[model samples]
Target chain A: MAEPAYLVASDSETTGEEKSSSPFPDIAIGIDIGTSQCSVAVWSGSQVELVRNTRNQKLMRSYVTFKDEIPAGGVSNQLAHEYEMLSGAAIFNMKRLIGRVDTDPVVHASKSLPFLVQTLNIGVRPFIAALVKNMWRSTTPEEVLAIFLVELRAMAEVQLKRPVRNVVLTIPVSFSRFQITRIERACAMAGLQVLRLMPEPTAVALLYAQQQQQSVHENMGSGSEKIALIFNMGAGFCDVAVTATAGGVSQIKALAGTALGGEDILLNMMRHLLPDMDTHFSTRGIDEIRRMGLLRVATQDAIHKLSSQSSVQIDVDLGNGRKISKALGREEFEDVNWEIFEKCESLIKQCLHDAKVEVEDISDVILVGGCSNIPKLRNIITGVCKREIYNGINPLEAAVRGAALEGAVASGVNDPFGSLDLLTIQATPLSIGVRADGNSFVPIIHQNTTMPVRRDVIFTTVHDNQAEALIIVYEGDEKAMEKNHLLGYFKITGIPPALKGVPEINVCMDIDASNVLRVFAGVVMPGVQNPAGPVMEVRMPTVDDGHGWCAEALNRTYGSTLDLVTVQKKGAH
Target chain B: MYSNGVGHLPRSDPLRFSFLHSTRLENPPQFVSFRIRPGPAIRSSLNDTISERPAMSFYELLGIPETGSLVEIKQAYKQLARKYHPDVSPPGRAEEYTQAFIRVQEAYETLSDPRRRALYDRDMAKGVHLAFTARRRGIFDEQMEEKSEWKSRWQSQLSELKRKSMQKDSDDNMSWGARMRRERNQSS
Candidate 1:
């Protein structure tokens, strides 16, 4: 019970190398979690606050319910109405079903989710459930997010009276790296200590780099450069970063996430108001989960009154004789979520074309979460960031207030009028790779690179005494290897036989500065010492959840005899 | 297991959590094995950068000249990023002025950008990246089939352009009176 923030961040790196005893511990905190609301925050000695639960409600509703067998969560249950939160015993989107996989088409469109998801599309882990009182109750999205991070660590250790272990959460830049290893195994099963997961628009560009370092202490010029661009759009991710900041750091420079959001605009307006909503709510009975919890609480109250009215008249009936009368205006709910707002303008034009940032050198175009309150996603992100957007924060507490200002700047918290001397700089939102040429996806850490990095590539063996290889480790940036996102695989097995493209392997990859992810590999062969095998690391993505049919059952139980490739170099990238 | 994709469930307490102290109980849904001490199995790109002669030439790390402008490389990178602003420097010289203020802001972000200072002025006039392999293969068609704009063709491309202009003056550690007036106009 005493993992005291890794014994106070390794005893402040062995006896205070003081910048106020480093490794961040102003009781760190800041959570977010959302795919349907969850909060928490901290640094309260003089700012970032949030933490409200005794139903004073500072967001909550992310879910746990199980109607008694001791389940509860969404921070101390408290769920009273909205059809007992679309009943069938509660369990909400555990952030779009955590580290996904029932052959994930977002877990087969969360099979008309009124809970009890099921999906046996073969690649595994998607049975979910909650339907309690009429029997069904299973669980695991890492035990409903470690039971909502143990009620957000006992409501931030009863409001900072201390001992609430590190944290800083806020993910989704299209997660993957085995959904950040099941959100760090649901924050080490709530004995919490994640210290920094970040990337929800780099925690809103670390709260726009502490609001441009408190507007650079009331306008001091010389340090120019702001750039921003954020655009979050919540309820299960839709990122897009582009940072740049300066002085109080914030780098990022280009992300472009997309597990599209507001749960695909409430499952595309509940399949445009039940056009036989998946054969009348696919069935777990109990009257089709109470007529799919009354048309998902009348389509979440006609999409929250079509965000300040323009026409909404859902009129559901489903008491087992389906009946939906529609009217949903706002240009027919923007023609039923216009391909999720034309995929939020190609994820803000591919994050300003991978941060060669343009839209007139953006300065601010922020827009945080909860589908950044619609108006056709604020006139298509203010007409593709031709600026005028910055809804001045609070789009559902701007990603846990930029993850509680990156939990007071990576917990080395300071700010003697210098605004928490910060430093964000992260990026690599997917593109880790490794699945040789013929199999394809070879990337080796490419996407938006930066982040506590360290790379390595050189691959080889492809047959002839391939002796043994199978390294697997994927994570999307597409281009085959079965369209990316695997994240773990090993099996080196003494390869001294050499030949085919003759050994040399290498691999490496690092990532640390706490976005964890190790990998390693190693193999050699020329004048071989301990090469041809003995070095297999693998910490990534702690692989799980039908790693796409375990990379098709390890390529049908080792097919191309442990393949490997990309050692290409005629001027490599 | 959802029909074999190892989507990791077969749980009933497969030792649920204990990730980072480098758990070596090997394999399960639980992992946190740090390891990584095995350093030298030999590598080279020479111990990856920070102490290599490879850096230094963003116009001599911003002392700026070869036609510097973007307003003199943003006023010489805002006076060397305000004399290396690691929180206004001087607190135990803020990590050696934040690693020379992040290589003087990565040489003022590659010389205040006009297409990354025209590709860092053609990789500082060919210290060998032949215009970065024709700007990363947007094809220079092997720089017009290997150098010669017909300047009296090749004496082996004039000793490979006099050893790439003396390896771009020892990688811009500078000794250039315009490379001694192009080696006395290629020795008259």
Candidate 2:
């Protein structure tokens, strides 16, 4: 009898010996686990080596399809065909689900993407459920990501012939502390130690700066100044960052990113072209187009052609003798995806505004990521920003290369990562204070001050014989604390009862280096010796684990047989 | 709101006016006066309290040149504050350090504000000339009371010391300092 598909193989040979003498692994991996496509790159001792999937492909379509039910013995044998046959069931663009609520605008926007998503109701907790196959079900974004990470890890392990452990994952600049923690936890569950969770634009800027350094050395003797604006247009997001360097200090002056990017533009173009097809046939007739996979292939082809050619004929292979073809020009593509182009332009302008600089101030503009290959996007950014864009390096691979350089720098190896001189960009609310009686927060710390600073406010008791006071902490510039998000609250107790106006209490709010806030209070009595005071400590909230979901997932996947082998080895010893 | 509440206070009791309400007083506390000893004279006001004092000019408090730029003034204040911040220093001395630091900070802030600094510069010109004449005559009004207080206090202390010395001479073999020096030499 065949073992269960979910069962861990008992006699599976563990490859690669643990070498204690080796200081560190020669290879470092950078995994860009994106929504539409997942790409993995491994940096060997020297250059980055792209690891292909089991099917020998550099990138995998982030789609998992499931069958209605298995036919008899099992569905594993028929899963591949079913994946293709029931393409409607295939859930793509999982990145949109990561760290988002069901009511989030991005979740609604994901409807435009070509995929099937199910909303699961688990008690009061509403989560996204993606059916990967008859036997596999992903109920959360982390689980879906774990499946992709596992595949990427296996690919790296096979290619390098060594155990790959350290990885650098890229996240959006706007990711909250909780979101970053969740991604970190998911990576940890997949047996990968995340060295750092770097912002995508920062990684791209580092990569571009590294390339510029190499060119400056090779062509110009030295001392040549170079500044670049990295416009990263990925499948699910677009972000722009301005990087400037003089001497050895590099700074990311500003960054702007949004949830709209290349995939949105393509979908918009698809909607435009598909409706035009309805002129020749009924809307329901497109069902045949979907079944034949012509719609998927045609849409992708048109996007590819638009990158290089002014116009290309999208031919729909009807599988029968009949065929349909339509010519899509650059003008038509721009008209169809004008909204996306406008968003990209607005983000670029926002970045420039935040930096308080002009386009002329930037020496070079580097276009990066797979979506950046779109000619229309490239032209729009260049024309609007009024700077010449550089496409000398592959945008798809730039972030990974930069991540590898970062890994090399972390491992104490000599590399170009240092020459890049990337600056860390952080965005947090400017002012923090507490609420008063009339729903007003007495402003304690003003915004725009470089952090790791503290400010104190002194308040007297309002009522006579009062012993305790509440310090309600809030984030935002709102005058009222109730209007802002209550970060945390602490009560200062054990104060000696005295006349209302006589007792004094000093509340100190300190924002630490990590942008986490801490509150400390001091209470004093009129004539008491060594009056009792209370100190309340509140840490930032981390991602919540709903009763060991990751641990159980790991056990179901890699537990039983491995444990037996370990037991047997111990017995033999 | 205020007119109706005037009669509420008892006539015999002193009606207290907070910093926010009253601008003038029958007699305000002298800010420049300090209790002097043989060592450095310590200011009576706490650091946070000096902000309420209106008599002292900003330039005199910060000890900075009139022509100092904003950056220079800020740097000087930060340096002085780090040196004198109560948290890092000896416990009891913090009150004095905090007072001086706050006065210095207030001076920097006043001078940094364009309008305030302009008014201050004019007032400073007249004040400096008066102070110079007062100093030359050896009749500095600010120091007169302080000097007299120090003199009278020291004289009384001196008499008490003489009486103690006379009593000690009959009983002890050496002076206190001499005996301490001898003990140190023996220990070494």
Candidate 3:
């Protein structure tokens, strides 16, 4: 729906009156279901049209307040006053909480919020609830997200004046296949088909690719392709991607992301301003919730002002004779959130190194997302890139806009419009492998490998007369599977009785273009199609609930007697 | 060849000549020749300095200046590596590109590591053959006396590292339970 930018895109710009009829006559919408904010946009015949709610707010607060029998999402229903939002009924930040176990630090962090977040830390889902009329009403993170999506869909349908079903959602690069499944289920619950789930920074890269294609028309310049470093950090996650673009081909060289963002910084600053503040603002009755809301609002506004000015003052009274008055400086703000800034710098460095590019190789540094506007964050990025940033794209809407462009491209819209030819060759952001080498994590497909990729690693039995070998699959960069995210696991039985290091158990991981991961395992003799054992192929991330615990239990029950070591890394050294 | 002027050619480079016994050297000196000039009886890669030089530093392979920043190093490697990446290049030249790509990758691996890069830089800075020079200074020489002590310490560490690596390579095949049992027995 960004007319000015799309105007610079597509061949239709040149053939004006020829295709004025409408660029995208039919298309699915792109939605960025962010942790704190959400937005939806679509290719509207000629250009993208950002759908707005009845309140005319393009960016809807991602929250579902449970008050009446029927809950209300912020997108569908707006509360008249800020105080009403603090009624201890709204469940916000569901994106961070979804698909997480109680032991997760983020779940622990959520315990400080206004609503109830009770945890046993026993690998089960945390208990989340909202206080309504002095009674605690239980809810799951998935339920909260489904309600929000339903509201967002209704708004988009109303604006499009048609039944909106298909959508392309922008997700964090660090999101595991397990997390993707949760997002798909949420979409399914909302009565929508997921045409594609694009990583946030990859979506930005697509937009950059289109821009590069359009710019080719104006400048007969350099003629060389350009490499862009896209750093996107919203309220919930921070993601980085390096892409090479030429003639509409956006080949993603590297991608890196961390589950840390504005919310963590805001929480850090709040704790700094009010020491032992958790004791005062922890989940309680509706009155304490109101106090928590007031303080949060004050802290958020102060942080926003800090971005513009050097300092800001905060004076707010949480009822019950609690008064807080403080003057916060910008340096103090950065000092409080040093880890966030440090991570931002390291992520950029890691992405650059992974892409095998030096700062000089980067033709443009694109900073997007809500956090990109912060002065300190911007300076940190400049320090790493050793150059100024390209801020032509609006920070707030870039991810959604990129997603919208992807929707048009994915819809098979061939064009008199130049944008349709845009293609992005993505890469795996993390390694996918299994536990082998006496519990050492052996990766079959490493991070930064071009997709859709297929690679196999051979493993052998650790003990003599072994029959079955356990293939516990995981995805992450860690050297130990204990530290990585357990995707799924299976036991490959019927290995012909053999001495240690004799059986050839092959484990191959294939990641298709759609980012679907399938792991295949079989015991094979060299050059033989039919092996001594059955070949098992299974889709990953199906290992349900507390996989961290499951990995340990498997090892405890079944010793490493049948464990396998890598055959040999197959690339020429 | 070991250049007295600036950087030495990598010993592994096919273009460089290695140390040979003075008795075996038919020609005295040429564009490149062993300068350590060992007595007819002695033969050692360490005590004798090679006209062979050391392996190429990661920086030299990447074609970036030694003083180049980390970013510059990465950029140089990336651009060159991409030119040789098999996926993008024509398949008919796959063999040629594959070899070149490996070299580019090897260069990047060393240069990108701060610890490894610093180690290489230190070694590069010590371009002179102290061991060769000290040997000629004789046992009674003060400089030789001090160097011998330093040389012994380095030799011991080198042997220790060799032992550790040999153990590690074989340990890769050992199961976790077996390793624990072995450790327990060793402790007992």
Which sequence of candidate numbers ranks them by lDDT, best first?
3, 1, 2
Q: Is the docking of candidate 3 incorrect, acceptable, medium or high quality?
A: incorrect
Q: In candidate 1, what are the lDDT values of residues A390-413, reduced to their tens digit?
A: 866877888897788776655555
Alpha-carbon interface RMSD for all candidates, in angstroms = 20.0, 37.5, 27.8
At residue A52, what lDDT does model 3 achieve? 93
Looking at model 3 chain A, report the run of 10 residues with the lowest lDDT sum.
A7-16
The local distance difference test score of model 3 is: 0.70
> Best by lDDT, which number?
3
| lDDT (10s digit) by residue, model 3, range A1-573 | 223233222211112222223233336689999988999999876666789999999998888998888999989887888667667788888888888878778888888777789999666688999887778899988888889889998988778777666578999998887777788888878876676788999998988878887788678554356899999998889999999877666778899998899999989987887787888765476677788888888999999999999999899998788888999999999999999999999999999998978899788999998898799989988888987999677888888988888777655444566665566667888888888765566667778876545555567887788888889888887533455788888898888776777778867666543456777787865445455654676878777756646776676577665577765324312
DockQ of the candidate models in sequence:
0.01, 0.01, 0.01
Number of the predicted model whose TM-score against the real structure is largest: 3
Per-model lDDT: 0.67, 0.51, 0.70
**CAPRI tier for the interface of model 1:** incorrect
Question: Which 10-residue window of candidate 1 chain A scores lowest in summed lDDT?
Answer: A13-22
